[model samples]
Target: MATTVRRTSITLPAAHLGEENPLPALRTPADPHQVHERDRAGLPADMARQIGYAPLRSLLPVRRLDGYDRHRTPTDLDAIVIENDRLRATVLPGLGGRVYSLVHKSTGRELLYRNPVLQPADFGLAGAWFSGGIEWNIGATGHTTLCCAPVHAARVPAPDGGEMLRLWEWERLRDLPFQVDLWLPEDAEFLLVGVRIRNPHHRPAPVYWWSNTAVTESPDTRVIVPAEEAWHFGYQRSLRRVPVPRWQGADRTYPVRGERPADYFYEVPDSARKWIAALDGEGHGLVQTSTDQLRGRKLFLWGNGPASQRWQRWLTEPGTDGYIEIQAGLARTQLEHLRMEPVSELSWLEAYGPLSTDPDAAHGTDWTAARDAVARGLEAALPRSYVEEAYRAWLASADTEPREILAAGSGWGALEVLHGRFKLPGTPFDEATLGEEQRPWVELLHNGRLPTGSLDVPPGPTLVAAHWRELLETAQADALVEYHLGVAQWHAGDRAQAVRSWERSLKAAESCWVVRCLAVADAESGHPKRAAERYLRAFALAVESGQGDTVLGALAREAVPALLAAGRAEDAETMLGALAPGVRRRGRFRLLAAQVLLALGDVSGARGVFDAGFEVDDLAEGEETLSETWFAVAERLVAGSGPVTETVRSRARAQHPVPDAYAFQPE
Candidate 1:
């Protein structure tokens, strides 16, 4: 079956369709008390504290453009359309090179959710994330920072006798490059998606890649995964595995009418064929099939409720509805659990298209039948062996262990920590050491690895701490070394030593991480005042560094308790007020700010923040949302039917039964 594929350019009206609004300048209120003052003997001191400011000025300069513009004006933007005999797909190269829409030509049905308007939400780490379509998320935590930005796109020569659309982007944090190639073979029904992530940096870096596909959610929409169990992080950061289809006494495989917003990560089985599908009652829906390289399939849903409705309305225009996310990840679990080595490339092949099962056949429970049907459909488009071979080659090239790579390349046989450096016995130590030479050691320490791949050695933390102390003798001026040394000490249960090291690290370099470490140590050491001050400093530094909402949220989570314990409710309110409007817009931070208000006995103010936070549409499950204590307090505050002051007092008293300091574990 020879099919012909064609590519064409098209333009569509921008989201607002008829408005021009300029984005506001990023700024925050500077503390009035922060003024220049001299020490006792008329000696000058630096008094301009660098807290409570926006950090996006350097990374994301204000730009005015039509396609994928932040303002969502009526400007027209260019797009690429590729079509075969059975399917049609549109690519928005200007908007993160997203697969804007995919449709079945014969039925005129949308296979991928298509947003009628382009509305950016404060959901991503870098603040702007759009709903609908398929988004490629890589690097950092949560959604990729580039979700709302443009990607390099080109028409590339296809070696497999098809029309290809190539999209590539350089990930800033990891200094790595990744590309996604979409190929539409002549007469083929499925679209071939080939992804390649390459690390050109000198050392290993944390890597997380997920292809987020949004599909229409309906009453009969059932998400089927070829797995028996799914794992999700619970309220206490513990991973819990539950039975597939039904979890917690409820059938999760299908969309229930009144279910709460949930997220589930299904671990792929070791079967020869792997596939995930969203089939409707009528047996017609979308199917995503991939090789073994992609080991995790995630389902995210915002259930039908007040919160979900409000959130959907915030992200899309009126008359438009919300969709569910079917994500595929390269790692076995979440992004926080994966890493990649330098000079290594990861490749995987995925195919997506509309699928129709026999109306008479039982679709949900027949795993073997479903697999065979998917395999047959895929074979109709391309040979299964081709994808298998591609995956095998990728596995062969993958450098699975950073330790092995470092040992083989740098001759740094089993890593041993020294002060802030790795002691490779004969390796020369100098002041101007290259980051390449130092990266492997940092990765080992950062990931908490021991030499010889053995677990019965000396206490890992103590061993690392001793080595870090040794490195400090020579690298005393290095703030990073001091920070890591502090971490090692903290892990070794030496809070006093950790605090001292972090204090020195703070003096050498005003980093968010260092300040945060000091804050935790101070809190645990029973110095609430010092802890509150350090938390404020850390919050300011995180904002200035554009570290995003997670860091800001974490700071708030730790700081609020310390502030309340220190009886500094006024200070907490002031800190919350100082946050930029952009930062306050994030749901996580907004929730924290509301909690701070509740702590200050301002119920109305807390309610306002809570109301605003619900406007952000995000299906991802977070620790804050799962907190039993926080929600109990929030419910009372939102309902306006409790002795608020006593409630706050009680919650505060029960405050942090779990050590809040350990929450600052470096990612």
Candidate 2:
């Protein structure tokens, strides 16, 4: 086939990405990878500056996505295929523009891991991420908040005058517009990707980009990068420089050799081409290379531990072969964000395809020689100069207008375009793209006031950037406006003012959403009792207003936990008991039930919850809640004989180990 772009469909056993949580996500990212003084001492000036650049305080304006369950059903998904004679690439426009598959036509080989199913897990920044495929991670240190969300996709003219698929969206985190243009030349094997992030704002913004590519994991496979040493990070909460290829007692190049999940950020020299590859025993696999702008490469190994294996299973179907990520980014580590100058932009071209080399050299004992061999193979297939030339050639056509729409994304970009009056070419966020979610903000932009009337349910997400705050400040105040303004104030770190605004909103009209936001503020500000009261009140209001089941469920999840934390065991019990059977059976609520029952001194009842096992479908990464809960229940059981102390607690924890089914913590 010549270069072609066409619509297609994929069917998989996928769980619905359920409704986004009505509750706001107010907490900051759990940044466990902070640079230590010892590690920072040897950094270069540019690296140091980028590492210390702006970091996010919270996920603000983005909502959490814990609403999904573990139910899987065969479903059809809309996909777009951009293919050439030698390679066929399938992209999922609805799922963060994820490239789901890349096939080598002549060899009948799949270059990417091609996950067997789509099972949402609590991994993305805002929640709900799945493994495998190529994920475009752009936002904070974690996976992109839009990992499970849709992005606008359209067909545009490629540099070769062939049709190319362009994926673009307005990134809410940094208030920037970005586009990913993917194309393949008629006779080319490499699928070229042109990425551009434009900052239309007057102020500078911190930008993060990581192209995460998951490849099939086999013991015979080895990852090769140009750097001799890498910044290694694991669950130990520390980063240290270590020699690559060989580490500890084993050759770390083999992903399965790792006993625990870890990140090896290759410190690729600025003089070297930015590329990474995972080659098998036969020296055949995927290779990713980009123009010099994307300077960092990483090898993320899920390890062979039970927890790692279980997580892999959780992400897809059982018996599916494992996968590891070969990633490229803008900085040395995901924890760092580069500073994009105001009114300026950053763009880079990346190519992904299969590479083959002599098996002996690829799997050689000499680390340097082994990497050199793969690099030679990559240079032969797609030379560094050729990639640079391609980048330069593609620049001219980067701004070509889209000829047809393949899929539509959220209305956020359209709203942002209206708000900023930004003149973005090539990738347009047309006013027609605006939907119900953007209607209120659209009104605010046109009428200079946020329309307010609906109080039956919770309010939609509120933008918290400085510009939106300024607009709200100038607009008239009402219950709905006040609620949104309070959220914006809260996001700006003005807790006192936020509370006052919510109070004013309450005086105007009672709103479960406003009360819930207040509860969150109080809960974090060391007013657990007040937070509990507010949560309960919010729940009551939700019920009285006949809010959606999702809203009621979300409120209960927060309220019972708050009540229990505040030592209101009876209230917590009552709230937990009042929930419908179906709601109570949700994995999150089941865990809460055990905790609430334990607090109420219903030891046997709590034990019953354990006997009737349940899974917290959205167990967060790095969370040890399952182990902690098990121990807490065990400690309560130990107290039955007599008063339990620290010694008794230790014995209880030692006596009751976390079962295999509940083991998800990195070992």
Candidate 3:
């Protein structure tokens, strides 16, 4: 039996109705210092020789146009539609080529959440990340640096008589290539997403890939993963493996009631097939299925509270009506735990579609039963025999140790293997199992002394430094250790040493964190020009990689000041000019840009910037709105006020304080 796939192009309403989206362009600057290959002693030999240390010398910020493009108007955009008898998928080629929506023909219901408006929020490290649909994230952590950016997309001929939509982009930091192919077969219930990541360099690079699906969250929405236990961390000291659905007196399978948020990553049980689903009370839902290659399933909850609801509204227009993310990862955990070998190609296939339970059994237990019933439906769709064959093939292709550890169980043993490979020390295991001699180091590593983004336990910078040095003696190749060491030094006020440590960290593995720290060190140490360059590089990396909003916002806070101090007023203006008017008008960046305009003697320009800033809606609660400073500056800059003086500008700058460079650390 042959399956036929059809591809057609259609115009659909844009995400941001009656709004404007301006594209920003930036160029990679030439390195100033004549750094040689030998200068990069900390880097892998092959990679060091290939790129040398030239770009490391003087990194510059990206250049933006004089002002945002107001001439361009919003209109219905073209989308590539691929369909079969059972399912139809629509992809927006211009908007990161994300899966805009998937429709199940039998039910005529959306399998993926579709955003009514394209209202990008300050969520991604790259400045703006939109909600809804399935976003393919790759390269660096938090969301691939390109979540809200455009990628090269095309409709290609599939080898199996179906049409394939291919989207690809080259990651700037590591020069790696990533591609995703979406296709559907005739009479097939699911749409398959095939992803390929290739590392072209001669040395291994840190790589991560996840497909984040946004689905409607209702009071009855429940998440189901075929895992007996889950590991919970983030915003807490106790990170342990516990039973799924119900753990530590909290039922995590369903959303909780409160302002406090809950986020956890579950390692899928060793099975022939792995699946995760978000089911409604009616036993109807969306299910994601993949082979053993994709074993990590994560659930994120925003909780039912006033603050969470407000945040939801701020992130998307018309809101998602409330939504949750069911993300599937290729690695055992997050990106910090995974790496891609040089010149190697990694590929995997995942299916997403609608699933429903038997109508006769709907009135049984509760939402939990509905979830189980949906899981059963998925199991029947892909039989055990078929899953077993796929799992065996995947095991054959995977490396030896990871495969063995996964086979053993999903607990500390697998985590120990990954930690040993990455040279990270903390295992979160029972301390009773350790010998007396190794107990103190383990205690220091696992003790509650480690900072978990809390003010209660003031960070032990000195203690952290000592522990990292001890680990470095044994695990010299671990780049993350150097990163932590640099963080400790920066906190300890050894700015020069911190910069040196970050330089070594970059050689081992290039990350945006190291670059950002270097920028801070340069700024605080009185090298404003160098700091400007570094901040620009960090911003470029974030923009290139599609980082979350926190990182981008931090970079803006640091870069604008450094550029102004370096007397690069025009450059500062250009950078601010590139941002979406909405982004530029909010937060500290708006005030900072206005000060720069005033400093340059463009009083009218400064007034215009201030007026635009006032037009934006107030930021949501808990956000860094810097309202006091904005208001104070606004009072002084208003139309009838006297000419602004340097003192007034200085006072405004003091109000909006910059955060510590390492504030946006990867967990």
Per-model TM-score versus the true fold? 0.59, 0.97, 0.57
Q: Candidate 3 overall Cα lDDT vs. reference?
A: 0.56
User: Worst lDDT window (10 residues) for model 3?
Assistant: 401-410
Winner on lDDT (1 vs 3): 1
lDDT of 3 by residue, 1-667 (tens): 2333333454433333222111111122221112243434543344334333122211111111112121223456546677887887887665667788889887898877777666654454333466888988775445544655556555454434445566665543344556666666556787777676766555776666778998988877777776667655433323345676666575677764323455567766666357788877787889998766787788777766554655676555543477888888875444232557876777777888888876434324354465466667887775545544543443332221110100011122222222233211111122233443233334434452222222111111222223344554344434555665666555445657767877987887666666777877776667888988887777777677666454465467557878888988887877777565656655456677767776575766765664554422223223433434343444455433565566665654465332221112111
Overall lDDT per candidate, in order of appearance:
0.57, 0.88, 0.56
Error of 1 at 229 (Å): 4.4
Put the candidates in TM-score order, highest first: 2, 1, 3
Model 3: lDDT of residue 368: 49
Candidate 1: C-alpha lDDT? 0.57
**Residue 250's C-alpha lDDT in candidate 1?**
59
Candidate 3 C-alpha error for residue 117, in Å? 1.0
List model 1 lDDT by residue over 15-53, tens digit each. Answer: 431111121111111111121233112311110121111
The residue ranges of model 3 lying beyond 4 angstroms of the native Cα positions read 1-74, 157-159, 234-242, 247-250, 256-258, 358-372, 384-521, 524-667
Candidate 2 backbone collisions, by pair: none
Off by over 4 Å in 2: 31-49
